[model samples]
Target: MTGTATLCTVTAPLTLFAAELGMDEGRIGLLSGIMPFFQALGILSLPVVLRFGSRSVATTALTMRYVFLGLFLIVPFFAARPDAVFGVLMAAMLGFAVCRSLAEAAISPWSQEFMPRSVRGRITGRMALAYVPVALGVSWAIQAWLDGRTGLDRFVPVFAVGIVIGIAGALMLLGLRGGRAADSNAPRRRSLTEPLRDRNFVIYLFASALQSIVFVSISLFLILFFRDRLGMSSGALVLLVALIPVGAAAGNVTAGWFVDRYGTRAIRTALQAGQIGLLLALPLLEPDVPAAGALVPLAFFLFGFLFQAGIAVGTVYMLNVIPPASKEEYTALHYSMDGLAGGLATFAAGFLLAWIGAGEVSVLGVDLGKYEVLFLVAAGLTVISALAYSRLHEEGALSVRDFVGHFTTGNPMKALWGINRYASRTSEDRRRDLAFQFGGVGSLLAKEELIAALRDPSFDVRHEAIRALGHISAHPAVLNALETVLEYDGLVELRYAALGSLGRLKATSCAPRIAQFMEDPNPLLRARAARSLGEIGDLSSLPRIRTMLHDDPDLDCRLAATSALGKLKDRASMPGLVDLYLEQASDRTNRVAEPRSKVVLLAITKIFRCEEEFSHQWRREEVQSGLAMPQILLQLAGRVRTGAPGASAKLRELTSDYNAEDTAATLAALAELLPALHQSRHRDSDLAVDVLNEVRTAAEPHPALLVAMAAILNRIFAA
Candidate 1:
């Protein structure tokens, strides 16, 4: 249906059609202004939308929009005067606007509510991929058809086809599952003033109003600027127009992924800044110059891309910030706001263009035309909008600087590079490009290319290839490749990566090969091998690991060995682990010794399942004074007990450095738990109560004690 709509009403044809009907710039602007005003009126139909559901409202409205569009296309044939033709077109446009506005108002809330939050951006992005090609083809075809025909003869068949196609599109909507009534309650009736009251929304409202005022001329005058100012032929103009949809499609697809990954605020703000940059470049584009063909299309493509991308991301952001109950109201209010601003802006632009009367004016030695003035104003308004957007907060949002850095360095560029190798001077460079480009978790689509790269002679190529394959480890080809690389690859780093990947994937079949690397000369490789063995849960390698734990001179190797012993539940290694801990525990003078001591103690706790006893051991040793062991123990205890209920809240209280006396008091109380739990097979209720009392007595109780205290009480209550 959207394809059909594109066929009937690509903006170029409508603007051209108005010109063919002898409409002046002011009349065209007035015609363009009619739709937004009707759209604003359409918002008042909220009660109607609520009475019937969104799907129903959208279907009905979309059907009516096409109906009027079909009528508008045909009505011109019967009109004798250009005024008669303009009047009928205006009425058709008004009808179309009413339908379009209702559809727009309901669709946002309906779609947002229907889709799960986790996959909405992904699904929307994928849908955009489909939307772009269809739109580009349809728009290209429509323009090509219009450019081929003389006069207004092109309208009849084009709009007729559109009506048929649009009806089919409307039918497809019947299958869509819109509202999940159970998940959300129906919205209550509220005054229209509610949305206007929000500070953020109000700020955004002003920004949007400014932008609407700025862009009112663009939709009305851009085609004229190209045809009249640039002297572009209709065929060439169609091609230029096609670039807009092409850029828009690409933008929507990419915007979905970024909006989902980075959060909405970053995407919205960056795209706004992007538009500012594009606007700044507009004056530099002298399309009338003999060599300006590429520049012309490039300008349209980038502006279309950034503008559409910003719209897509901004829509998602609005959906997120608005609550479920008020989504309909907020969306309607936004449309109305745009309509009011657009109408006024359109009239003002028309008046300004009329006053300027098609001649160039010099302002500060630069040639200023009405189009240039409008674009510059739009750019200025966009700056304000971007500033207003900066105040928005969303979880997981990147700052503008971080967003730019990530885009320049991340997978978006990788995808772009895959399409065109950006200045690769060597085969090795190309291979490296393919490696990072296709190395992500979802890069299985590039499996064959990645597999081929694995055979490349470049070590960097092979290393990155191995790492990329590891990311998609669940793929059978990738898994087999990693296993082969680990066993037969000549590069040690590649084999080491494969070993770690296999460990992360828990490839128990690779255990024997990993065990061989346990004695590798490279200490990092040996440590990783031991860690993999533990992760694979292969107890057969326990003795070899214990030997490493006892004899490995390398700190990392010994630490990895102790970690393996702990993971394997090897209680026999507990004495060695405890010895390792105690040796480092009293070395208060060595900063490095304290962390390793904690790791050793943690290993003991992991093996014995006696975290309380271990926590106390470190805490009591600190009572000797001027040692950091107590703080380290508190951190370790906090980590070890993270699974307990309210554990996070407890850690916050305990770890805060605001009150040193309270922190020490809470730690002192918590230190009593290990002995109490170890002494009785069953928990001693009196001892639990005493510990709780001690914690409660502190001026500000530490959260760590609250957690330990809860564990003691639960054990006591269970007994």
Candidate 2:
């Protein structure tokens, strides 16, 4: 599946690159459209391929694809006339498409065997990052070589090189040893529609197919629009085309990380925001201006990034909702849907281009070219697709932590709640439930009913009620009910649920009671409390929160405390915050190591206004405690000076007594901290001069750090 998908993606750009060789857009569309037809035919052969064992079938199909691609390169060299060229190109596309389709079908089933169904979406999404970069690089290099050349001669060598790469890629597949076929004793189903009968799978297929239509249309037409109407050169066009892949890569990685850490909701929300931004930005880009030309790629990159990430994340999430035994069939159905959608989109784009007259259209006082209007329509459809996809509730309705905890413990309750209570339910039901329970249900429900739901013997109902309470933000009665649960609930899950619910409700009224959980021996409870405190945005908890930053035994708890303290914007906690920051910076504990610590440091720098005052106080205290070393103190002093708004005199004072080692280390730390501090209304006067002096005297000055420092100073000075 991967190889075939890679081939199809790789070929799209090659066709686009060939279009630059004077092939009309209509012919390019036809050539691009033909491959999917063969691909669809190949997909129908999956039963035979799977019967042969996926690994063997995949390898053989990929090998044949490379051979056909090699043959394709030779066609241009041997064909004497344009008619022959067209015939050969079409034939090559058909053959290549067949091999690709077979490969896709074979691989899709095979991938399910190797990866956990829960994370299949992320795996597929991340895989695109790998394939896209390679595709972009190869396509760009081919176009670069073909620059200033005319005729099929240049394309022959370019495609010949692709053939070589294709061969290498095929050989790489040999490492995947296919497992033996399933036992002959297994029941054989004869119905062709058996797989599509799975309701969840059908919904997933529809969502995936609709999304593909928008994706394929945008991917195929954008390059031509940018080149013709926008007047983008070959080099610029390559870069623009590259953005979709690059953005896709970035979005995929981010989506995976976020889905794992925060859950599917975060990915969904982010995907919506990103897609909307990309959609709105496309028509605004002034293609004729060189400066504006950059937006074409920038927009596509962000669009591809968000859309692909969403697809990848959503796919895995949907897979998680379905039974594992059905994965192969479902995946096959997905690809089949993709082929159908791809065919329809190609045919539609070709017709739309011709119907729209290949020129500008005036809509709402804005002149948009025919292609641009197509993109606008595609973007609008994409938004609608996203909304529809978001509505499908296969996975059970659960908050991020609940979902993670449930999955980690191998519990199905979370999944069930998502499916029954959240996802599959109507929007009216969701909104009504959310508003009733979380919004003001405490006021509406009889006290007995509220208590009964809370104390329900059925764990699933209890869990759902608890989740519903989280959604009730404005209801004081719900807040009170959650508080009662927090005080009495025996189950750890129940207690965590109450805390999480209160937090989401932003029940600041419960802040005092919630603070007691920070001292709970259970690390999970403590972590949840800290997160709730941050969400509540109550400053009263800052002292205890700051203490937890250093004293909590669990790293998760400590990090949560750090996060909470930052959100509270409590500058009085700065001394403790700084201590935690330095410890995190210097500690070798892998448990506490994460990039979020930088965010903590950055947050502290923003809230604290008087670094010089804090440093002077620290120096005095350290001297009095008999724990201060002049060298360490001097470094600390330098950091303070570096952070000051206009501290030339202070920096000069510190520089006079600076030990070489202390100065070097302090300089490095300051180099890191300065920009973060500089951005906080602290850059002015001769602070830049002092930093320059410190940079010059450092034993091992980092060139990159120095450059960053210079850029910071320049921005400050410019402002």
Candidate 3:
């Protein structure tokens, strides 16, 4: 359709062909006006779409459009006279227009049904991008072919190629998953005129129609401004025309990102205002003058860009405003009105040209003419449209300042930096309050101030200060402050924040102190202590967490302990968790068992990746034979929280071969793995056989291997 539409535009072979046929400007206007006239009747075509469903109607229309395009190619070959050729051309165009109108009516509603609202702007922008290169290639190909050739003969091969490409597009549509079932038997919920009863929708309808007039005016006359007013060469005109699609393509890319993230109301306002500005500038510049020729392509580019951006955002905005149940009816009405306005606008441009003439006129000492008057009038209508658009509301829209910030920077990280700086300077809070805000922003510059804020007279300030410090992660100063807060701060919230921050910072040295908090009188404090211990990843803290999970009277504290054990990923907690589950389940009246069961399920899921157990097992076995096994070996060693092999003389000899860190890690891994291996033997898991085989082979008198073997056996069977 795009390739074929290009051929029929006012700038194209149709314009020259009309001239060759000696058709007057009024007749040429009527020719360019054909599509929208039928498209304005697009609402009347809705029954065809609803009857067969949008998918079927759209596909059939696209197919028949190509059939008409084939006739367009062959018509010129048969008709020798200008009258016959003109008649056939008009007939072909009418057929194409009617088919396209049905498709246009179907596709918008079809797109709305399937496309997610969150990313609609992005997808629309990408669709515009896809159109750009094709439009450019077709424009270049047609222009280059017609450079030296005259008459209708040049279009034959172009139309033939268009038919082929259009067929490919049609075939591609056949594969689309027409999302919803065609509910032909569904009862009508409301009359078609019901949407017009919506006052806001009526205002939107007027705004859309007004904008459509200006858009059509620019598209119909921009080439004439370059050709008649500026005297640009055909070659220059061809190249300048390509700039329109390029700019529109670029607009889609940015417009989508802005619309999806920031909402569409601001984007629509800005683009409409931009269009008005560009239109107002049209009368002041003369491309024929020195240094002004450059503005012609730029004006055309901005024109296309603004048109596409406004339409893209407006379409998204319309979807947002319309009731979901009546989307198809409302959308069809909107397009019908838009098409009517565009058709009238095209005829009005021609009528003004014929009636008022293109001769120069002056107003307010400004050099203006008929084209200039047209531009000014269009700008006036766009102003009204812009005002009307502003009346509509959208949810989650960014403030104007933030929208401009996003527009200029185009990166969220940079936007956050800007926001942080603004919050730092503009906030009315005192230094301590400002420090708290900076902590939310994760501003490293506030580190010293946040550390100082920890000593503020107010406990609230100290609580926030600890939290902020945790977000920055612990430095030596932060760790010291947290320790001081835990030891001296009388407030429970402050103490909880301090423990949490220590765990988040992975302050390994603080683990013992955090462990002692598990015995605090407050069950909440005990829960926090258990969680922090797990976060610190200290194996020695396992005994405290295990005791809390099993013996704590408070269910919340026990649940937290269960979570901590899961984080530790030790098999040693399995027996205790199973016992806890059975104890809770035994009481039919216990409401707490459900949540506790979820916690146990979660722990087991985390330990084994229940969803991907086979995959993990495969990866682990693969890693055992590879160079990366040492890292896994160290992690396994770290899991050996509670039980250990008493140093068998054999195990001590093997321990002598490794560095302190590696030996400790291996011992932890073995302690954890040993209990898991014992359970695996009952289930007849392959891991049990592998572990037994490894032990038997290593039990040889080679002292180092024997020591390793004994470490495994002693950890497995020891109480």
Candidate 4:
């Protein structure tokens, strides 16, 4: 249909052939209206189509359109009689139009019944992809053949090729699924006015009517304008006009996805706004100007882009708006009325041109010619159409106000791209990507997609969805969704992700609820809760976190508590931080160096405003090896907090001795010593150091921890 439609319908070959038959722009415009006017009568054939079966009816009609097209080959035989040629051309084209419309009317219901809804968009998109290039290739060949031709003979070859291609496309339709014959007893039919009873659909029809008129007439007339005003050859005209389909093809790439994300109304309204601008520009492409002619290709490209994109989005809108029971009737009426409008407008435009005459009229110093006036009026109607369509209700559609933001800030298009890719993916990795895409965008559309993603059975996808909800904190539902996961979700990872996201959102309302998770047996959940409290700035949870810092059985929980204290920046937690340092530094049970040692030290250093001085000192090997050193420094911090200045000479001696100790050997020193210090600390450090060296040389292998216990008891005695 695409390849044949270009040459055999209201396109370059047909219009040029009509012009060659001595038809003016007025008569050519009337000729362009022929197909659509006949299309308005297509609903009359619906009962027959439905009874015989849609595929069969569509296939038969499609084959017959070519039979009518074959008459164009006979048109050149009557070149001697102008009267015979015009009558023959009109009659053949009228038959061609009726058959084409019958094919369209039947194909819709045939597809609706045959194709599964899930794959319809994909199948049609693939069809468009497969046919557009073939159409372009065929049109290009015709352009090359018709480049320097004259008379009706030039169209004969083009028509012959169109007939062959059109018949082949028709025959291929027989292989499609479903389209079985309806029952012998037909069901009672509803009134055609059923769709008209829908107030919103009626509103939609009004906007669609105006849009159809402008879109249909503009493309048909641009060819005539090029020929009459620019002296462009038929071949050059066809080549330049072919960009419309190319642009339309490009537009379909994103149009359906946008309709899915942003909804049909918003996408359609925006496309109409673009069409209005394109229409206004058409009037400016005046004759005898190089710049005007240079812009012709671009103008047609935009025309095709907006035209096809609008139709693509409009199809989705109609499907969503119309009920299934009356799908065929609603569809038929929409096409008939929209085509009727376009047909009438095209015929009227020709009469308008004939009425306006060739001479220019000036108003406010701007010259207005017939084509310019026609285009400008079309632009004006389109503006009104854009405004009207903006108000039509489509459930889940983006409002014009926020849809405008898609141009400035949103990922509606990017989300659509991800969704399109996501639909075909089998792997969790591929499917999980769409969940992550919603994180940075504030679009509620993205938020909705992310919410749906949460229900995805794949843990990775749901986990990412929970994480993404954290980034979009504007909506109350975002907080609610995150909290729901934190409270009831059985997946520990998803709950953990939810907790982290809640903190990222700074959801203080969820903070108290989060604090309860501090006691969760899952160490990751406990750590995450403490971390979220810090992130949420839940100062009331500071006491509990400090307790976690001192008493959490898990090393990771303790490190998390230490990091949380750093984030909270609470001066009152200094004693707990000091105790944490003292505990890690002196424990002997923990054999390997862990992040706990460095994390606690960093927290104490942060409270002291010395993190910059200590930042480079927290590497794993370096921090654990210097545990005794930080242990001494935390002792100094305690004295400083108690209003005592450290003695510089003693500090230097301790630092030098600590640097001389074997780092790997002393990694367990704090592990041995600090556990015993929970009981008490020795004031006499000299005696303890001597006992530690003696125990190191003992042949009986006395544990350093037992010796440290003895030192703690001695401190208790001293006390």
TM-score of each: 0.58, 0.55, 0.57, 0.70
Best by lDDT: 4
Q: For model 3, what is the C-alpha lDDT against the true structure? A: 0.67
Give the per-residue lDDT of model 4 (tens digit) for 1-719: 64655454447788888777777777778777888777796678767765786778889998898788777788778877877877787888788889888888877655566545444444445555666676577667778888766666877877777778778878988788877666677574645888878898988888888888887788788888767777888888877777777777666655655665567777777788888788777766657667876788888788877877787667667766677666768877877888799889989998888887778867689988988888888988888888888888877667887667544544666755665566665588766776777676644556666777778888888888888878765456678778788765468998999899989889988887899899898999999999888888898998899888778889789888888887888766666665565566555678543335556656655544446545533332244555434454334333323222333233334445565244333323322442333333444343334334433432222122222222232233334
In model 1, which regions exceed 4 Å deviation? 74-80, 179-187, 209-216, 287-290, 407-719
- 2 or 3, which is superior by lDDT? 3
Global lDDT of model 4:
0.70
lDDT of residue 525 for candidate 3: 83
> Order of all candidates by lDDT, from best down to worst?
4, 1, 3, 2
True lDDT of residue 540, candidate 1: 95
Off by over 4 Å in 2: 1-13, 37-39, 75-80, 118-140, 148-151, 177-179, 190-192, 262-269, 288-290, 360-368, 396-719
Order of all candidates by TM-score, from best down to worst? 4, 1, 3, 2
Query: Which of the two candidates, 3 or 4, achieves a greater TM-score against the reference?
Result: 4
Superposed by TM-score, candidate 2 places the C-alpha of residue 138 at a distance from the truth, in angstroms, of 3.5
Residue range with the least summed lDDT across 10 consecutive positions in model 3: 698-707
Root-mean-square deviation of every model: 20.0, 20.3, 22.0, 10.1
Higher-TM-score candidate of 2 and 4: 4
- How high is the CA lDDT of each candidate model? 0.67, 0.60, 0.67, 0.70
